[model samples]
Target: MALKYVEEYRDGTLARDLVKKIHSVSKKKLRLMEVCGTHTTSIFRHGIRSVLPKGITLLSGPGCPVCVTAQKDIDAFVAFARVKNVIVTTFGDLMKVPGSSSSLTKEKACGADVRIVYSVFDAVNIARENKDKEVVFCGVGFETTIPTIAAGILMGIEGKLDNFSIYSANKLTPPALAALMETDGVQIDGFILPGHVSVITGTDAYRGTFEKYDIPSVIAGFEPIDILQAILLLIQQNEAGKPALENAYPRAVSHAGNVKAKQIMNQVFEVCNASWRGIGQIPSSGMELKKEYQRFDAAIKFAMDMPDVPEPKGCACGQILMGLKTPEECVLYKKKCTPMNPVGPCMVSSEGSCAAFYRYS
Candidate 1:
């Protein structure tokens, strides 16, 4: 069979050439961080780390939505499960994230009526079917998934599904990048920016961050070639002492991004301060339902209030997310916290650095 478009990008010869170029140009001890969980997994899956030069180190950032979700938010999801006549719906990754005292899976096992939903619309459909039951969807993701949730809210409004609501833990990318730069011990030479999030936010969304920090950054696709290409670009920039933000995946991304999707998002939601698991609250980094859309706000409807909780002791998820440590450096990594019994959100979520390390490394 002829090679498909995607398969062509994964070609062995092309990848090797990029790797050789990366080794050649990479002379400085560069700490390049792939600021997307998907990129983290992809790098590990393709053994990109193994092929890289000894001086070049790749770090994982606060890119995994589930991994970065605050402890209080997880507690809120569990709290939703405890509400009477409430059907708590969420993405599959959230099922195992350990909240302060309990997880959604534990709540469901204790009969809290938690359901795994693939989309926000699925939760809306459930709410429509069970008119008497309050359906709360745990909305957690980045720009790629937030607009769809907004569209689902619009759908719920059209269908008059008053029982349907969402607890939005949706986050923004650029703000988090700025937060990373400000972090005390966090050291990153460059960033392998998220491709999917960049598709919606466009390259322009990061221009402010890039211009302010002057870090060599590149938006890359999930494929090995794309990542290698991005690494090569970052290396080239660093070697030449020229920092820039470039788009390696221009086929799917542009300078302005998806305007219609952003418009839909802005219409339904507004910016708010959001807490990251390891990283503390970053201002204007979260999305919450606007006043006009508060009817769909699950936290308000259920009167849910969860106090913040500290992460597990010796669980280096926070440090790992900040690119300060790797999974191997964590005390509880494979010894105490396997995926079967995850001590941290990083182990629970598939895109998490720990989970990616466990699976691919």
Candidate 2:
């Protein structure tokens, strides 16, 4: 049964069949945006881009959480590292992301208390162990990771760990998708939706946006067959002149997502205006600690006031995220902005389109 399951999804025969079907149905040139960082990585890892027809252009949207996090938020994290007796904790990817002036790694090298944590609960534990020091977690993610962060706050509160707080830069996936639709000069025929985010927000969360824009969207898993199937579905919809939102990854996603997780996220955080690294501020796209949960807000606790710093000059990360430009088109790409020294967040993040392109292409 296990062998059948793996072969069913990853079988060469199935993937080739889907690709042939896609090529047969696809007559018109179409632009499809994959709105998840992991999808971008998977597509590259599986060499899906090379197999696709030249008529079908796949663009990577604002999928990387670390890539989309605004420069101001990075600065705030760096600010925490500079504070005396304060422990700044964040995911490993965030440690290399440069702020307006410096990065967490640089701060740590300068004798600051910066730590890389795998989870928010680990930061909470650090706070619990060191009562004399303040532990601030740099929270940067989308719907897929927000619920766990919310639960960690509740855990801290229950344990009476007052020293723990979070500088939330969490973004909502549906809102970003809506924002992309409204962007000028952006043309997307279909949306290859994210599987993980859909598992949290569900197919219903994308209904309003799909109804408004009337774009064909398919929530797909990470497997090669799964992506190829989604592409075939998108081609069929475009050929029939029908635009609808559908879930291709039914085994993992549903109409109604994890209800308890949503409740916990709502209990701890509220919607606010959020700044995207290259896309600017999208209203009600960011998550912040609620009024009752203000005690756990790291920005509030540290009195952090980050400056409105602009992105790196000549970096086309914003345009790349919006599908207006590809990473190869960027002047900084491969010249000055390699993975070792990324000029923009797109190169720094593992899920970033630029990073995938560099690795695969």
Per-residue alpha-carbon lDDT of model 1 for 92-113, expressed as tens digits?
9999999878999999899889
User: Can you write out model 2's per-residue Cα lDDT over 1-361, one digit (the tens) per residue?
Assistant: 3555445788888888888888889999999999999999989998998888999999999989999999999999988898999999899999888888898988999999988889888998999999999999999999989999999999998989999999999999988989999999999999999999889898999999999999999999988888999999998999999998999999899999888889999999999999999999998999999999999998888788888898899999999999999999999999999999888999988999998999899
- For model 1, how many clashes? 0
- lDDT of model 1, residue 330: 98
lDDT of each: 0.93, 0.92
In terms of lDDT, the best-performing candidate is 1
Write out the backbone clash pairs for model 1. Answer: none
What residue pairs are clashing in model 2? none
C-alpha TM-score for every candidate: 0.97, 0.97
**Candidate 2 TM-score versus the reference:** 0.97
Q: What range of 10 consecutive residues in model 1 has the weakest lDDT sum?
A: 1-10
